[model samples]
Target chain A: MTHELATLEKQVADLRAKLEGIERRVPSNKLSMVVFSGDLDRALAAFIIATGAVAMGMDVVMFFTFWATPILRDPAKKVEDKDFMGKMFGTMLPKGACSVKLSKMNMGGLGTAMMKNLMKQKNVASLDQMIALAGELGVQIYVCELSMELMGFKREEMIQYPAMDFCGVAKFLEEAMDSRIQLFI
Target chain B: MSEAIHADKVMDLKGLPCPMPVVKVSKGIKEVAVGQILEAQTTDPGSLTDFPAWARTSGNEIVETIQENGIIRIFIRRKV
Candidate 1:
């Protein structure tokens, strides 16, 4: 009985040492978190960052608050009703690079028609595809609780994603503090 | 000797940009059969790092690499 007990103890110790070796080999730079304030410019940046991060083998979390939530809202309702072309290509060409102000640059009643033309001409991705790609690659996208309440948005209004969650600033900050790059956008 | 690919075959990826070569190579190699050689020539400097890593990740064989003058050429063979 004593010899059998010693053999089992040795086996357990070997297993623990092997597990420790595996633990040490695991890489640490695998996590990232970003916060996007409600802005079109920032939303675009966040989308690009999230896509790039996933491709580079890092886990990414993006918290959308205030103005940014609208960018993730129903693509059918939001993008179709506005001047999306000017928002994408901007106005004034070379000099007017920053002219397409999302908050101010409405093409009046002709906004929706311009968006249709732009979508057809530019071959831009729809919001649904962007969200789908983000979700497919394990990007966590959280909608801010305060922003949701302020905007009166329900869960159904947001694009469906497995990583989608509604959380407050406190939780967001806790997650963001550990990330390599935490952007307000 | 210049390794020859069949007349019906060519890896034509002109006007492709960085990080795109990896995607294109990924999609391109799928069309070639196992053990067939693929000659990948790209202008994107990122391919220097990207394609090798991709070859490693996908378990394909990178047979040869050369930098002639300013252009980069890589020869890869499908493993499985």
Candidate 2:
């Protein structure tokens, strides 16, 4: 009985040590953001959360889909070679992060300009600045390939930032599975 | 001012809003060596909670926090 008890104690100690090792090795600080809205406010919120998480030494991944894909578009590039419907939609959509329409009270683009000015006056980083900061901080920005296809957006039409990549839903889900913070914005 | 503690590096984030202060602090902290102090000055009201919360999660130490005339100062020590 005494020998059995000693062996059990040893086994428990070994298991505890192993668990501690695993815990130390596993990365517990991760944030995954699913950006599904193209609204200026929502995009700002998403980037804010991502930057905050990255500041806390957490790995951050932003997955852009649907209307949110426009947030990744290059402000300088105009999409010209698409089907009639695609061109119509593209022309109607906001060009990029700097031009994203507000979700409410846009007032034919005036609200967006007003909001941008307010953010600027308040010294808050603009969406473009936030995106740049995200790049600097190694925050991964992934655009959903399916969404891009549906929207008739070519990869060349998007901003060519180092942190930005094109991926499918599976990639987003894979990253999200291990993230401690998952947000849908 | 004479009673103020010394910091290895001082970051001015005045007039910045939520998340910017924290983001800038995080970036600025890297310039400080481990065990060194970083002082961040911000006008944002949110830093009251944001700074402490950030320090707690990022394995850093907040040695002191002071607010006066709507400006907030946080002294943090890098742990890792």
Candidate 3:
């Protein structure tokens, strides 16, 4: 009987410790999101999430790697430098429609053009504005060091935002693991 | 601004979205000295409900909430 009692006591202690650890690490406020994709929609979504998190009294961090880094490129352009076609269309079309073609991947070139026109009518926030607001609201923007080198982007060429930081996948993974929410946009 | 002006502090959350207005306002109000007033302006329609609910949960008093030009102007006097 004593043995059983001791085991139960140990289990209880273990559970208590686990609960305390969770309470200590989990955010006191709302969700934490890690967005993975760098499409315009993803960019906008990340901004909304980060800004929303901050507005809701939660800490927010965004690790921009891969294609997402272009959104953070200094002399920030409406479209990425890598996609020459996107830039051509971005310059030709009004801002909102610039991302429409990318969204309708199956629609062929014309479909994308139509989508852009439709999106503009919907009053969605422009890609550039979303990036700006994310910076303004103090969203932590981290550039993947490896992705930066591979993309041939110099740190000096990246957009200068107070919340911007640089790190690797491992560090981002560590931070994302502790968050209440993780998003791959 | 009405003459009541019962409290001295102010919090402006105008043009911010849900959770953000609440977040900023919550932080802003916490810093005010007890018994001081906090006035916040929020463009988000949802703050009409969210702010008061948060205020209740956080133990702050919502002295008044008025709507003008589609914006919610809330007056909170820190009770706790």
State the weakest 10-residue window (summed lDDT) of model 2 chain B: B1-10
The fnat scores of all predictions, in order, read: 0.00, 0.90, 0.17
Clashes of each: 3, 0, 9
DockQ of each: 0.21, 0.82, 0.19
CA-based DockQ, model 2: 0.82
Error of model 1, residue A129, in angstroms: 2.9
Residue-level lDDT of model 1, residues A1-185, one tens digit each, is 99999999999999999999887665444344545454333444566567655554456888876656655555332222225443442112111111222333445525534653564454433334555767776788878887666545556655657888889878777676556566666
Q: Could you tell me every candidate's TM-score relative to the true structure? A: 0.52, 0.88, 0.61
How do all the candidates rank in terms of TM-score, highest first? 2, 3, 1
The residue-by-residue lDDT of candidate 3 on A1-185, one tens digit each, is 99999999999999999999988886544444555555655666677667656655566788776666666664443333545554453344322213323543535566655555665665445665666666776677777887666655656656657777788888777777677777776
Q: How do the residues B1-80 of candidate 1 rate in per-residue lDDT, one tens digit apiece?
A: 35543322347554445434554566677678888878777666666787788787677977777666555677778776
Best by TM-score: 2
| Interface C-alpha root-mean-square deviation, candidates in order | 5.2, 0.9, 4.6
Best of the candidates, lDDT:
2
Grade the docking of candidate 1: incorrect
Per-prediction RMSD in angstroms? 8.8, 3.2, 6.9
Query: Ten consecutive residues with minimal summed lDDT in candidate 3 chain A?
Result: A92-101
Worst 10 residues of 2 chain A by lDDT: A21-30
